[model samples]
Target: MNPVSQSRQSAIFGKRKEPHTVIIARGDQIRHFTVRPWIAAVAGSALAAVAVGYLLATSYLVLRDDLIGATVARQARMQQAYEDRISSLRAQVDRITSRQLLDQQMMEEKVGELISRQQELAARQAKIGPLLDSAADLKTSSDETIPTPAPRPDVRAGLDATTHSTLAGFLPDLRAGSANLSAADNADRLFVSINQSLRSIEADQMDRLKSMTEKAYRTADAISNALEGAGLSIAKGYGTSSVGGPLVPLDQSMQFDAVVDELDEALTALDTVKEKARQLPISNPAPGKQVSSTFGVRKDPLLGTPALHAGMDFRATTGSSVRASGAGTVVTAGWNGGYGRMVEIDHGKGLTTRYAHMSKILVAVGDKIEAGDIVGRVGSTGRSTGPHLHYEVRRDGKPLNPLTFIKAGKAIAGLI
Candidate 1:
């Protein structure tokens, strides 16, 4: 081969395989090192690889720190949101509990008030029971029938149905802290209904008391009229008694108290009349025995001539029982001028009764006696021509018509 061709080939190949030279000189001493082409190439490649690795590592570290910070911030925000939600739920629960407590307290207060009213009504009833019974007696004795009052409402039973049911339905919810405004409103309505019922009962009681008072007044007035017709005054008998007190007006504000006071006064008047009638000579000495002669200006049985006779004569057999006409104390029991084996009784209110012409005297002076008590035996004795009883009535030592008393007694027989 030609030398020129070979040199051209070597030149191409040598350019690629060229070696690198490194030299170091300090002062006059100098050092040099030769590097082969392959060695230099390898060293350059290694340096480039190291530089790329360092850049990659720096970028990874910076990006990793940013990612960690972002993740931590997101987690903190989520935790704050959850905490806010929990706080709101807790506040709602507290409000509901507070409302329930308020409702429960109100219910308790209302119940207490209702119980107080019930107790007051019961006390009033206790006081009025006897008064009503007395009024009923007066009604029975009266000639004219009195109107009966309506039956009273049972306040306790009605209140129990209304108040108890409401409480029972709402109490559990309140205890559980679940009651709301609607439940409270319902309870209020129930309490109002109960109060209304109590008011109605109170009104009924007042009406009944008033009616009883009126009835008592009527009865007392009737008794007074009857006594007046019989020539007797209740006041005359009661006024002389040792009983007196200051008169104080009853308070009108307390309705029940005022009505009760009126009833008491009327009953007192009636009692006075009854006592007067009992003491007076108002009953027949001998029941079922016909009177042979009437009182006042009758002919004497012994003389058979017109004369002033101040007594009635009962046609009865000898030894028949002779009863006192009224309750009294015996004043005379022995024979007087023309009255043999006689008995005279002194009743109160200046009234007296006498039983004369008796076969036997059964009572003595100062002996207490009552109407229908056997005081003598019927017989023809003083100023009599046959077996009979001489009965007489006197007021303040003056003779009164015995028939008048007998009629009055018959009129009031069932009353006093």
Candidate 2:
């Protein structure tokens, strides 16, 4: 109804609003301000936007600092993990290296042991070689001296080709120290083969030693038998003088040494028996001489009567040489009662020989003489009907058959 009231109503309801007025009083001063509704609204909104922007900026700064810290911590953790992994890998490498060194050392020790065994075998061969040579020599001598139906195989041939080849192949590899861990299994097999070859050589050497011992015993027995057949007693023991030493026992652990000792004993026995056979008078006194009268009961040429003859009469010239039958010392070298111009030789071991009816005596009493040594000259003297020499063999002052000695000498001529 009124104009002021109408204008207020229009301003409240109109699309284009009116401005408002503000009054302020301070002491005696008074101020009035006008503000539009749209302007106030825009100013409030701007203030709200500025407050939001400040809050957002503060939040962003604080969160950025926290994110930087978290990133640095994560990087540190990753670095620590990598360091641990490196340490573990290093430990594994060290373990592998140690294992390889241990394997190499063990391989070296095994190879050294094999080398020592090879050296021992070589020493054994050195010892056996001499024995084999000696045995071969003995066998050869026996073959030449005695007659046999068939020739025997050589004992030295027992050393086979396998033994030599195995030794030759394995020794160089061992000496060079060329074995490695990669070839450990192969080295073991080769060592086994070499050991087998050494054993074979040892077995062959043992067989040869046994054979030599047996042969020596057999030879000694044969010599004893021959001597005994000729009415000669062999002494049980010989070499009583200049043969004294300590009685050292043999080493039982070394079988080869014991066997060699046994073989040497057998050879010594053979030598002793051979020496005894040589001492006996077993040779012809006058070689190529015709025997006119034999030993035992026969007709005497001087008396032409049945008598006992104690010697053999050899038909020879007046100046024929008469030699000693065996090695001895001359006991009588002068004229005797029945045997004129005689020479009596005293061989050791209760044996003696007599050369009777000699023209001249060349050997004197107590003169040393050997078999086939000229002692006198033959002649028909002192109860001899013609120029003939009488030869007699006696044992312990008892007469024996001279033909027995002569026959025995022929049988063992090659052996002596």
Task: Give the winner by TM-score.
Answer: 1
Predictions in order: lDDT: 0.76, 0.73
Clash pairs for candidate 1 = none
- Top candidate on lDDT is 1
Which stretches in model 2 have alpha-carbon errors above 4 Å? 1-137, 141-183, 237-253, 288-290, 315-323, 359-362, 372-388
Candidate 1 residue spans exceeding 4 A from truth:
1-84, 129-136, 139-190, 236-253
Model 2 C-alpha lDDT per residue in residues 8-93, reported as the tens digit of each score: 88878875666888999999999999998988999999999999999999898979888898999999999999999999999999
As for model 1, its CA RMSD to the true structure in angstroms is: 8.3
Q: Please, what are the lDDT tens digits per residue for candidate 1 over residues 181-242?
A: 36667677666766776778777666766776676666566666776798976673333468
How much does candidate 2 score in TM-score? 0.59
TM-score (all chains, Cα) for each model: 0.69, 0.59
Cα shift from native, residue 296, model 1 (Å): 2.8
